[model samples]
Target: MTHIVLVIDDDEERARTAAEQVTDLDWDTDALDVTVLHVFTDNVEGATISQFGPAREARDVLEAAGVDVTLAETSGDPADKIVTYAADEDADVICLSGRKRSPAGKAVFGSVSQSVMLNSDRPVLFCPPE
Candidate 1:
């Protein structure tokens, strides 16, 4: 069966990490279809997915690893959009980066990763970020 993976990418390091993690999975690369989703909070410069470094990196790395990859873009609250998109795509799993945050910082400003993890029915894989 084809397994769909939704990678919510926002930064180059995290995007590459998530893509690499997907490649490392025991599943066959041919059976895995990955979509790198980037939610735009602001696009004052009129940026597109092609112009985004994170999405480009994810696509390049995954493709080089022999995994099918695509790029998707949207504008909204990242957590909500990620969950919605995953469901829309019927994704088998979701991948994203979790920044190291202090307890107080997390409490004050909720994490998109944490919110998605709690709200998404699909399994979520969180990679590392600075």
Candidate 2:
């Protein structure tokens, strides 16, 4: 059976890195599928997935690795959308690229990663930006 890895990230270079790292770790798997998910909150600038370059790059990376890759996007609360999609898909693993934020910033802007970690019952892999 193929394992499904759901990767949630914003359009950042670090997001690509997280996807790359996850793919590298599972390079030897007999079958693997990766779904790159970009959740666009009200704060996001674009409505289309094409606007998310890094997420597309991450999808390309997985595709080049012979892994089945799917790119998807949805507009809503980032954390809520991510967790809901993961659960709905019955994803084997969920990967997130984390960013550093001050307490004040987190309070004002909210942290999607934190919310996902706290709410998701599935295994969540937090990848810190290098």
Candidate 3:
């Protein structure tokens, strides 16, 4: 059976990290289908997800691992959209790059990964950015 993985990140480094985590999964690479999702909260520039460097880079890494990859985009709140997409895609797992932020930093800045982890029902694989 095919395994669906959703990778959501805006930056190239974080996206690459998430892709690496997906490649490390126990599932067979041949059976893994990955969707790289970029949530644009405010896209005044009118950019496409395929044009995003991070999504493309993530695709390269996953493809190198022999996993099928697709680039996707959505506009809205990151946490909300991410959770919606995960359910919409019926993703077996959601991959997110977690930044090491202090509780105070998170309280002030708000963590997307944290919100998604709390709100979504799907399993989440958090790749810490070290």
RMSD, every candidate, angstroms: 1.5, 2.4, 1.4
lDDT of model 1, residue 45: 93
At residue 128, candidate 3 shows an lDDT of 84
Which of candidates 2 and 3 reaches a greater lDDT? 3
Candidate lDDT scores, in order, read: 0.82, 0.76, 0.82
What TM-score, over all chains together, does every model reach?
0.92, 0.84, 0.92
Q: Across residues 6-103, which tens digit of lDDT does each residue of candidate 1 receive?
A: 55556688778877777777878877888888899888998898889988888898889888887888998989999999998888888888888999
Model 2, range 1-130, lDDT digits (tens) per residue? 4545555565568867887788768455447777788877664455576667777788777777787887788878888888899899889778888778999999998998889889998888888777
Q: Candidate 1 versus the native: TM-score? A: 0.92
Q: Which pairs of residues collide in model 2? A: none
Clashing pairs in 1: none
lDDT by residue for model 3 (1-130), tens? 5545555566788778878877886878776788888888878889898888888988998999988888889988888998999898888878888778899999999999899899999888788875
Point out where model 1 deviates above 4 Å.
none
lDDT of predicted model 2: 0.76
Please identify which of the two predictions, 1 or 2, would achieve the higher TM-score against the true structure.
1
Query: Model 3 Cα displacement at 82 (Å)?
Result: 0.5
